[model samples]
Target: MDEDSSERRWEDMELDILVRIFKTFNIIELTSGISRVCSTWRLACSEPMLWKTLDLGLLKSNYIKIPAAPYVWVSDSSDKRLMRLLKVALGLSRGTITCLIFHYDLYLKDEHLIYTAERCPRLKQLVLPAWNQITKGGICKAIRIWQDLESMTMPSIVHPPYIMEEIGKSCKNFTELKLMGPCDVLFASTLATWLPKLKVLSLRCTVLTKEALILILDSMMHLEVLNISHCVLREVPEPPAPKRVLLELDETIIGKASRLREFYTCLEDSCLMSQRTKADEGLIRWYKYEEWLWRMDEVSSLSVAMEQHVEVGGGGSIVPS
Candidate 1:
């Protein structure tokens, strides 16, 4: 309100300082003043580095420009609105975005997903959930573009072998993977083979049988934390007497856990009472089978009898020196 205050405000106008200050504004503020200001301010506002990350989630949210500016979708330019944002950010950042996270609910078109993967060449970590149009190959190509990527999460993955192979070949820094679908043995084997440093793996292999489960863990020699709570086949007949959280296949896999630290095989109540009964009966049968197995030089078939013994710790392939 005072004359001195007004004079001081004008005196504080510094072009160099404005450039740094412009970096913090959202898309709207940046564009509104970027070209309108003098060359110095315009250059600062238009810096590609400021646009390295184009988060379309903001468009879905309340923050980003509502119905992005018209010019963003130039009729002649191949890059449309969101695509322009992608290209602009790509140009500005000049390979600065290390992580790109698409909102879980985002329904991307195949074209959108492909363009994004093509543009974000330096992206290191990507998290996309429920992007129905995205296929195994698209993800593989996008991830392969980032050599230093370390983490990824996606939902409803159909096949993981090809994707895992791409990761193995391109991103050696990768160590963490989370998938929210059927965790088959083949996919697990591929991942285990490629990710040597991997320590955490979460697969929704809940209902998988013991045979498939064992095969999955065969390759994860360095796995530490495993959460199979959502697994379908892990329903224990009854809780153990001491009652510690262990999976149905815990006995078979734990021995080969060269670097494992934690394993969770919690289950729902679908098979609660029946599970306990089966577990109790299964425990007794296992010991007898183990005794019989040990009587022979080598057990040929892994029958229920041998399987029972294997489950109850009667005998294992851990031959002592």
Candidate 2:
């Protein structure tokens, strides 16, 4: 009876404390190390709340570099390991995953995504930077299953209409979107038509067209936040130059967007950190500077600067446009 009393007393410790301790673990240690220590630890590890935000960012450490490629590729061994880790993480999640972030270097296959989608039906926010191998059909199938999805950060695909349409139809709460590539006229128009209720949009460090910018500002009535920092705007020449010119957002656009809770334009030309040159296009890989890329101030900044319309103050707070 004494031994039974001791075990019960140990188990009586606050569950919140146990969860706090478990949160310190990396994916590998949480899955393969602490989970197997004892039933109590295993139970703690399997807590649904603990698995809500499954950040696979550390998986980048296991990525194998491929020669002559700008992005590193995951090896067969790494893929198998990742699959196992994902299985363990999702199983522990018990279908309660809401936010998932993948590393830029990790190449996810269709099967991997399908497996995740099948389990994480409650997922709301997904950040996937690399989609080199994921086909349209594969992603669409997953998106269809993700009925509750709200926010997503995705790679730039040439054709985004079908995916946008799919999300518009299925995800009623879908609002926030961040595109990591060129937001051209067609893409912007598609978004404006399909996702009229979109609230937050980030087009940072991409090729943004002037027409597309105008369309988004004019059409998306529900927009509350906009980020167009470091974007190379499509030139608006008299006859239209073949090469797109970097643009400065005029007052009209700023005035419209500034009505929102937050509006992020661009930084001054003198600010080396904010100025993105044409040559720098696709040159700075996210993985190389993932820490800086994901910094809270930089990632979530709604600060702005334009020719004279808007400026982001030192503290990243918004000054009047």
**Could you say which candidate leads in lDDT?**
2
Cα lDDT tens digits for candidate 2, 169-233: 99999988888778877898899989999999988776777778888888888988888776677
Candidate 2 residues lying further than 4 Å off, grouped into runs, are 1-16, 66-71, 236-240, 276-279, 282-284, 290-321
CA lDDT of each candidate? 0.50, 0.72
CA displacement after TM-score superposition, residue 202 of candidate 2 (Å): 0.5
Off by over 4 Å in 1: 1-81, 135-137, 204-212, 234-250, 253-258, 268-321
Each candidate structure's TM-score, on Cα atoms with residue i matched to residue i, is: 0.56, 0.83
Q: After superposition, how far is residue 251 of candidate 1 from its true place, in Å?
A: 3.5
Superposed Cα deviation of residue 63, candidate 1 (Å): 16
The lDDT of model 2 is 0.72
